[model samples]
Target: MKTREYTFFGGIHPRSYKELSNKYPIEEYLPKSQVIIPLQQHIGAPCTPLVKVNDYVKVGQKIGEANGFVSAPVHSSVSGKVVAIEDRPSSSGKLVKSIVIESDGEFNYDDNIKPNEDINNLKPEEIRYIVREAGIVGMGGATFPTMVKLNPPSDKKIDIVILNGAECEPYLTADHRLMLEKPVDIVHGLLAIMKALGASKGYVGIEDNKQDAIKEIRKACKEYEGVEVAVLKTKYPQGSEKHIIKAITGREVPSGKIPAEIGVVVDNVGTAFAIAEAIKYGKPLIERVVTVTGEGIMTPKNLRVKIGTPFRELIEYCGGFKGTPGKVISGGPMMGIAQYSIDVPVIKGTSGILVLPEDMIALKNPKPCIKCARCVDACPMNLLPLFISAYSLKNDFDKCKEYHAVDCIECGSCSYVCPSKRPLVESIRLAKGEILRKGRK
Candidate 1:
């Protein structure tokens, strides 16, 4: 079959640097002594602790209960005793309530974990229930509750589901590896999603650069009717949900509206794999594949990591730092969160752990915008980032909102293309936050 390439407007192609870790297959990394499970890994309300201090918890046991429909429950990654439940630092740079489990050395699985019936026998509500009970969320970094997405508002009509296989982020290759290694599972997951949403069509959108992954996914989808592979042009933020939807369906999601508003839904390939595991093996989301790579590390690898394993442990397993580590990001360099320490545990949204040395760190002083309009041409959202950022610096949030600052996807494209090295995305992000905050008042 001929692979047709799809692309969206206003995107910059930076150095992918994917080869640094794409060659390595995923290796399972188990925590040695303890695991710290944060209660609020998802985007919604934080989960409430179900186990107090000194309580014994088994592997895949629910340690945190979902507080609302938008939230996802948290499970223990290891069979251990709950030593403490206190506020702990999270990858989002906030102190969230967390449960600390001391490994008992014997990994015991929860009795509730057992395979379900065949996918053909399951109903739509059954699929949503399974996804919710499994505590699956958007594994592509959004971390929004997957169950909520499956159950869109009654007014919205979702006709298509897109599985994002485009690991377009620089230095991240977890989704790419998953597509090559578990293509069947990913396809099955996509089928399950389509069933849950009652969507008639399903498509797996992968980057053309990953020809191997595209071939694997296409082969897996051969038996499934209404499912096909759509190859995307290699570009930064091409894997973003909005961009992927635009590329695959040519549907534009209006500002302040979701993909569901346009009769479409998007899920990460990793999320689809999790759904397959949840329905087939009755497994909760306790582990995920994380790409541990960058120039500062002695060895780079893609590892299937437990949810609560510390970043430090993964780094140590990857041969530790090779040189002076300047920046440690919890995802890709383009949009990942920079960490002050490696003590943070791997959450569901952690697609990669990138370490950069001092030499690679570009320390350039902020210069005045040259008015080159490069940022305008590079913004995927087509918002004037230069004006939004400038107004934000002046504390004119109303002007920023008038410029549609909230529409900014925060993909860092404008910042990447800026000639003056201005923090375009950063300032726009600040303005967006302020705009939303004032709206609430």
Candidate 2:
């Protein structure tokens, strides 16, 4: 298949450390002692606990019911008794209510876990119901409920569906491994998503660096019409939903708007696989592929991990740390959140666990901006990051809002290109929080 390379306006080519884990096949890991399933894993309201302490819960059993339309339910990843339901540290550095369960080692499945109707016989509403019931979310770190994307406004016409296989984040390769190992399932999941959204076209966007993944997905798409693999230029943040839409379809999502408004919807490759599994075998979003890697890690490997498993267990399973870990982050280095505790449970949005050695961690003070326009030129959203940072530092959030700081994707492109090592993303993120908070008030 002859395909042209596609990319967005501005993105940095960060050194990809994917080689450390991409070559390793996914290993299945069962929680050793317990699993801590959080109540709120998605973008919306937290789910209400359906099971209390000391209650017997089995794998795939719903433990937390979604309290709102925008949220997704949580399921037990192991067959055990609920030990406790209390506040615990999460990947976001916040204390969230979690359901703790001790493992029974049986790994029993719920009785409701059975095959659904064939895809061809399933209606759009049925597909949406299956997705929602399965608790599938955007596995690409956004953690937005999948059902919400499927059910759009009647006025907005969705014509294209894109599966982001472009694992562009540095040192993360779970999506790439999924694309290579489960291309057919990913394609089937894309078809299910298209059928649900009434969309006619589907595209899988893969970065050019992962040639093997591109080839596998392309081969899988041979029998399917309106589904093709769109090769993307390898760059940081290319896996972003908006950027993938822009690269594949040449459509720009408006500022402060969603892709559905632009007649498109983007889902991660892992999310697609989960949808496929749910439709085929009635599996919930319990286990996910996680890349546990970094220079600080002794054995870097991509493993299929169950949700609610502690980070420390995975690290130890990978042979533990090579030396003193300076920082542990969930997701990629650029956009991932740093973790203060390794005991935090892996939530639905947890993509990868990145551990950096002490020597690699640099603590430097921010210098004054030299006004060289590098930040401006490197901003993917075309916003003035330096000015936004300046205004934000001065506590002039009004000025930050005036500069359209809310439009910033916070991809850290500006910070990566800044010569003075300014914390452009951090300041802009603070300004965005204050602006949104004030607006809500």
Candidate 3:
């Protein structure tokens, strides 16, 4: 396929502060003394605990089973005794039932792991089950169950499956590192997804800044048929579902719809890695690579942390903070949550834990709108953020409805572009909550 620069609608040019941690190769994090694994790590229903207190379990044993089709199973990340199955803070600033395991210091792997005999000879349904049992999700923050994504509506007739390699979010280099370090697994995972979806043609979209990643993927996929690598412009929201679809295929998923409706299904690069593992070695998505870096951090390193590892331990594993942290974010600077505490457990979607120094982390009171309209231009969804924020403030749900507040992708572009420092995105989130509630009622 011919290479080209494809792009989508409105997006911002935020300060790409990736240089802080991009220079280092991804290093494995030494297992902490304890890891607290959350039962509900993905977008589906919470997984029920299959192990009880004091039960000894291996590193790859399934501790939590999905409650339904929407959920993914949870696994133990270390060989140890089950300490407790109780409520613990997740990275999203909420508490959920977690299975805390005390590590035995000796990281032991299950003895049954083996490479697949022949992936092509396996049935498609078998591949889907491997992906589902693997507990994989859209590692790019959506955390939607990957099996559900691969199994779009039979009526949808998806024509394209796109691999999103764009680590568009600044200060997060997990995907970039995965692309560069584990390109083979990534390619295999992409093929596994293609087999699961039965998608004849697929594309890998990587930003220009990650030229090394693009090069790696291109080289890995040279022998594979029906897969092409496409380079995209380095932009903030390039990894967003709709933005990625538009960038590669020039297809617009209409408002109030999913990419499946447009005959496309976008999967994250990391999710592909998990699929590769599930299909090849029968491994599940119990753990992932995480980037723990920021100005307040003593050392910025990419770690392979267990799914339920405590956010505090992950920080301490990196030699603790160099300076006092003013802002502790769970994901990226733009879309990550300003964590209330370090005690939260890292979930599957936990890409990076950024702890900015007191001086580096800036926050100011929301100022009165100056009608600058900078937010209007930055919104990738093309919704009027200022108008939505205004309607939301007035408690005028209908007016907010008129402004399409529900359609906001929450990419943080509006807040990023607002010179007046208006909290347009936060107000819109409130409107979204009210709208969804009312709709449910």
TM-score for each of the candidates: 0.99, 0.99, 0.97
The per-residue C-alpha lDDT of model 2 at residue 320 equals 98
Task: Give me the overall lDDT of model 2.
Answer: 0.93
Q: For candidate 2, which ten residues in a row score worst on lDDT?
A: 374-383
lDDT preference between candidates 1 and 3, better one: 1
Error of 3 at 15 (Å): 1.4
Q: Model 2 off-target regions past 4 Å?
A: none
Ranking by lDDT: 1, 2, 3
Clashes of each: 0, 0, 3
lDDT (0-100) at residue 86 of candidate 1?
92
Tens digits of per-residue lDDT for model 3, 213-309? 8888999999999897888888879989889998888889898898999888899999998888877777778778899998889888888877767
In candidate 3, residue 21 scores what lDDT?
79
TM-score of 2: 0.99
lDDT of 2 by residue, 191-221 (tens): 9999999999999999999999999999999
Best by lDDT: 1
Q: Please report how far candidate 1 places residue 371 from its true position, in Å.
A: 0.8
